[model samples]
Target: MASVAFGYLPILLFLLVALGLSTAFVVLPMIVSRFTGAHQPNPEKLSEYECGFPAFEDSRAQFDVRFYLVAILFIVFDLEAAFLFPWAVSLDSTGWAGWTGMMVFLAELGLGLAYAWKKGALEWE
Candidate 1:
């Protein structure tokens, strides 16, 4: 039991250091800014920054379906690109199975892209 607890000492030390650093990073800046008076709030600074003007619609306004579609498509492709790097790195160890699996994944993404293009989801108008 002592050895088991000893094995976790490094992890506990790491967590302590991480907590200390994170707390210092967050609290030190506020303390420095407070003393320097660099974070003074103003009406202009507090106002909305979007569109460089006051918002015309409610903040909870509904967006078009195309907006969501585009966002989802971007996230899907972005994750697919992220997966490629790890798959490529492990390809030698994984051999033919990895290669074929990635090929299939790419093909599926290509087909989805084609389907979306055919449905005019890629069009801005």
Candidate 2:
């Protein structure tokens, strides 16, 4: 147990130092601000700004379905691209099995893209 603790001593010391440094950084600014700052509040400063126009309605309004569809499509394609990196790195080691797996993955993605295209999800018009 002593030997185990000795092995972790460097990690423990690192954690303690990190905690102390972060606390100092956070507390020092707060202490300095208390000494230097005065409270000033105005109604105009608190209000949300609109593009040169006074807000006519509630800011939280319902969005269109197209925005969600585009977001989902972007996420799907982005995740597919992320998967490609690891596959590309180990291509030689993976051989036919990995190649077949990637082909299936790509085929599924292509099908999804085709479905979205047919549904007009990809169209801006």
Highest lDDT model number:
1
> How many residue pairs clash in model 2?
0
Best candidate according to TM-score: 1
Model 2, residue 5: displacement in angstroms?
17
Q: Write the per-residue lDDT of candidate 1 for residues 30-99, one digit (tens) a residue.
A: 9999999989999988898877888889989999999999999999999999999999999999999999
Can you write out model 2's per-residue Cα lDDT over 17-61, one digit (the tens) per residue? 999999999998888867787334577766767576667778797
Q: Candidate 2: misplaced stretches above 4 Å?
A: 1-27, 30-57
